[model samples]
Every structure is written in C-alpha cells, then in structure tokens.
Target: MTAARTEQAPGTRAPDAPENDVVLRLEDLVVEFPAGGGQTVHAVSGISLEVRRGETLGLVGESGCGKSTTGRAIMQLPRPTGGAVVFEGRDITKLSAAELRETRPKLQMIFQDPISSLNPRRRIPDIVGDPLVVWGRRDERAKVVPEVLTAVGLDPEQVADRRPHQFSGGQCQRVSIARALVLEPEVLICDEPVSALDVSVQAQILNLLEDMKARYGLTLVFIAHDLGVVRNISDRVAVMYLGKICELGETEELFDDPVHPYTRLLVSSIPSMETVTGADIEKADRGRGEMPSPVNPPSGCRFRTRCPLATERCAAEVPEMREVRPGRFAACHYPMLEPVGAGAAVEGA
Candidate 1:
C-alpha cells in the first residue's frame, strides 16, 4: 500500500460554489429496479458526486457496478427513487415532464454502442438533426447538421445522404457524437464511448471528444471500466464497487496511491508490459474472487465480501466515505493508507 501524502485537500469545496463553476451535482442519489419475486436490485446506493464546469469527472467500475445507472439518473431518464439531482442549481428530479423535455437539450448522453445508437432507416442529417427538430429548429438543421458533421471529422456533403448502414463503427461513433453535439449541450454524459471501438479508433474518438469539449465548452461525466482511459481523460476519478463509491479523488492521486483495497486491486489488475506465465498467474490469483450479486450484496460494506483487508468491524458497520487524506476520500474500515498521525499507522509502516 502507498503512504498518503500531505497535500491541500482537493475534495473539500465551498458549500456555495461560484454559480458558473458547478454544472451538475448529485446528492445521495439512489436508483433501484424491480427484479420480480419481490426482490429489488440496488443499482445505485446513495452516491453523490459533482461535475465542475469544463472538467471531466470519471466514474469507473466493473460491469454491473451501477456507473451507467448513476449517469442515467442524473439525466432523469426514469427519475431516481431517492436523492436530488441538481443541475445548474436547480433540482431537475422535481421537474415535470414538460419542463424536463425543455431542459433535456442542455444535457445529452452518448451511449456505449455507437452503431445501435443511430437510426438505421434515417439519413445521417435527419438522425443528427433529430434533437434540433424536437426543439423546433428543423429549418436551421440544414446549417447546423453540416457544421457538426464536419466538426466530428466527417464530410458534410458526402455523408449527409448516407444511412447508418453505410458507415463503419468508428464513423458511426463520430456521427453519434455529431448528433449529441448538434444541440450544443452544456453537460455531456459519455457512457463508455470508446469501449466498443477498435483500440486505434478508440484513440481517435478520445481525441475527438477532447476537441469537441473545448469547442463546445462542455462539462463531461465520463463513465468507463478502463482505468487507463479514465485516467488519461479525466481531471478527477471516482471509484465504484458494487453500488457505492469506495474512493474519489484527483485521477493521478487516486491511481498513484489508491486507499481502498478494491481500488488497489483494480489498479494492480491493469495489464503491464511484462508477460505473465504459469507461476505468476497462480500467485496473482491469491485473495481475488468474482464480484458478488448486487441483489444480495454484503450487509455492512458492500465490498467486504471480496476485500482482502476486511475485518469483523467491516461486516458489522458500514464505512462512510470520509477524507482519508488531503483531497482523497475512501469508505473502508481500514484504508490502505492514512495521513501522518491520523490514526493507526499505514498498514506496512
């Protein structure tokens, strides 16, 4: 485990942030789904996060960790079961359907699968222009669609008449981005936007997104399972396990010195240049297990079941997210690292 460095706390923020600084805030957000047989799947459990203006906040976790669910809740796709979603200081969860529709254009989502996101029967222009049409800007789409298409590295004249089937996966993703940006949204939720693309194409799309963010002055909530991708693109990163955030801090800080056992596992799991053979693979498998089902997650700490350092206290009491070090927060009974004189010494110190 890495030792916690003493630095100014980055997680601490003014209660009243400047009006222009915070684009979105999620307060104790919760989302649940009916799984039939009187069982409910706790997809998201009291997660709170904020997206600062012009910054990318990465939400990372394995599949079924509720990263996507948290993103959708912010957009009020089905409205969360509990907690408040404040967008630009207004509680969007309380907005009526008509009101939400009017506000939806300002918050757009780019899904994981690019090919399926587009309409196969619709032409590129119409598909990209759909949001504009919905917002009563049909006539202006002629001007808007071409500009967005060009911005996303596609030829306006050549692809304008093409259907979804005519484009490759990378091209289709570019088109999807063009469509999402056509409305000139303020906050863009990119849910694993590059996970489905080829590695070479993924780099292209990532670069394109960075360009688009600057051009549009957009705030981003980037959700992904790839730690490298998230660290490369995000200013801050939040680590989720099961349905709760286990750690949140600056990307470089979190990756360099993860305080949560789960986070350490994830960081260590990232593939390196060195080749792994028989003995190394066996040694690497020590104390690791498959993720538990969210429907019946562990009682106290959701991650306790698989956490290597879990103790009886971890199973008896839920660990709240607290500042384990300056600007870094973790929810663990025994954080891997701690600031000097804060509590029990660092695990190996």
Candidate 2:
C-alpha cells in the first residue's frame, strides 16, 4: 500500500543536507506499469528523498523492493508515472527531449551487470567513447575517453582495442564506470554495480568508486541489497520496503539503532559475530513471511503483513514518515525503541 505523506515528508531533506546543497530532490516519486489483466506492478510508490551535493546517499532494500527502480526513475529511464525529478534546482521531468539531452551529460549511471551493459560487438574504446559521440562531443573522444579509462585503472593503450568479451567481469565494470565518468557527470547513479562481481573484485570496485567520487566531486545514489557495502560508502542510508522508504538516517545511526521493523529485520539478516539485539531478532522473526504482491499490496503500511507489531490502526491508516529521534525518520505508527501506546501490537500478531 502507498504510505501517506505528512508535512515533514516530500520536504524531508537528509539531516546533513543544507538547503542550498541539495543537488537532486525527488518529490512524491511514483513509477508503475501494467501487469496485464487490469493489474499494475507498483514498481516505485510515492516516495520523496533528497541527494545532497558531494554525499553518497545509499538506497538499500531487498530484491524487488524498488531500490533499482527508484534509481532508474531518477534517470527518467521510462519516465516515471508521476512526480517531479528536480536536478540542480530545475524539474528535468518537465524538460523537452532536446532539453533533456542537454541536461543528461551531468547525470550518469553504472549498471549492475557490467559485461552485459557493454556492447559485445563494439571495441572497448568505441563502447567507452560512445557517450562523447552521442552528445556531439566526438572531437573530445580521443582526449576524454582515455583520461577516464586511466582514472578507472584501465590502461587505454592495452584495453582500448579489445572487445568487451576479452576482459573479465570486473574489468568490464571498470569500463562501465569509465563510460559514466567520460562525460564528467556531476551525479552518478550506481545500480548494484558490484553485485555481479567476485567478493575480492567488489572491494576493488568500491574503492575505485570512492576514489572517483573524491577526485571528480560527484554525488552518488548507490543502490544495493548489500547493507555491508552501503554502510561503508554511504553518508546516509534510506531503507526501502515494498515500494516506499521505511526509514532514513545517518549510516551508523540507522544500522546501530534501526527504528522501523523492516529496517531492524534487514540489519538482523546481515551475518554478524557480535550479539544481535532481542528486539532485532524478534523483528526479523516476525518479518519472515513472503512479501505481498505489489499488484495487490496490503492495505495501509506495506510492511504490516510481515511486521509483528502490526495493529488494527496499521491496517486502517497509512503511516506517515515522521522523525522518531533528533534526525532519524521512520514511517510506522508504532516505531521501534518507542513506547507502544494506543497502536500497541495486536495479540498473537
């Protein structure tokens, strides 16, 4: 179900965000598609978020939870069904096709399957330099393409003539990254860029991304199901469930003290040697059921079906995103670490 928005939401900027520093803001973003038979796949429900300049905002959630959809929506991949995507203070969602082409250079993306994303029929240089050619900057191809290739740790001299199939998966990802950086984008959206790589290669790619971020002054929207990876790179984290954000806060703050039951379950799911909290275990256990179909999502809170603390109010009224602490926000009528009052948990729930 789509959660209701409060005054704090749609206007809920990241805690560390300064009014003038937000590079991208999503206002009630929604993306849906026909599922046939008069049903619709609620890919991304009404959700609002802000990406601050020079900060990595990690979007973490389980598979099919809309993290990747949200990332693609920011790029206007299919043009969201609703809402505005404001980039650099202008609503690009309203921009004309030609206008969008002019604005696209400042925003780039690295896909999950690096090898598949790169065209096998094209040579490395052609693949990486294609952006320059497309944007009418072909004159700068020889200069900028090699520069980005070197920046991403690939020797243009060696790999430039080779095809995408010649390099390993990790190398192809580096190529994808180089292609994204070739245009010198101000914002980079990484859609699970490392999920298809080896554990060892994941670290290398992660390190490279951080290095690139610092060297190029790029804002990032890192979408992944791996909380460990998100914790290492993100300044702030937004936990999504179904199609909405359940919690958002500083990386460490949210990881250490998750407020939403869904967030707690995600943390508990991570393999840990340290003791897990009783509350976290309980939340995780309660959240064991299969996720409800997005086409016919549960009423009120989307997570209520699996949330053990759900009550009648949870079924009747949509939870609004609200600050449960100084800076942390959660969209649950009965947030964790708070006293359960009138919306107390239902018996045997």
- What root-mean-square deviation over C-alphas does model 2 reach? 4.2
lDDT of 1: 0.82
Question: What are the RMSD figures for all models against the true structure?
Answer: 6.3, 4.2
Q: TM-score of each candidate?
A: 0.90, 0.93
* Error in Å for residue 341 of model 2: 20
lDDT of 1 at 167: 88
Which regions of candidate 1 fall more than 4 Å away from where they truly are? 1-20, 274-285, 338-349
lDDT winner: 2
98-201: candidate 2 lDDT, tens digit per residue: 99989999999999999889999999999989988997889999898889899999998998679989999999999999999988899999999999999999
Candidate 1 per-residue C-alpha lDDT over 173-265 given as tens digits, one digit per residue, 9 for 90 to 100: 999999999999999999999999899999999999999999999999999999889999998899998889899888888887677777777
List candidate 2 segments past 4 Å from native. Answer: 1-11, 338-349
> Residue 269 of candidate 2: its Cα lDDT?
81
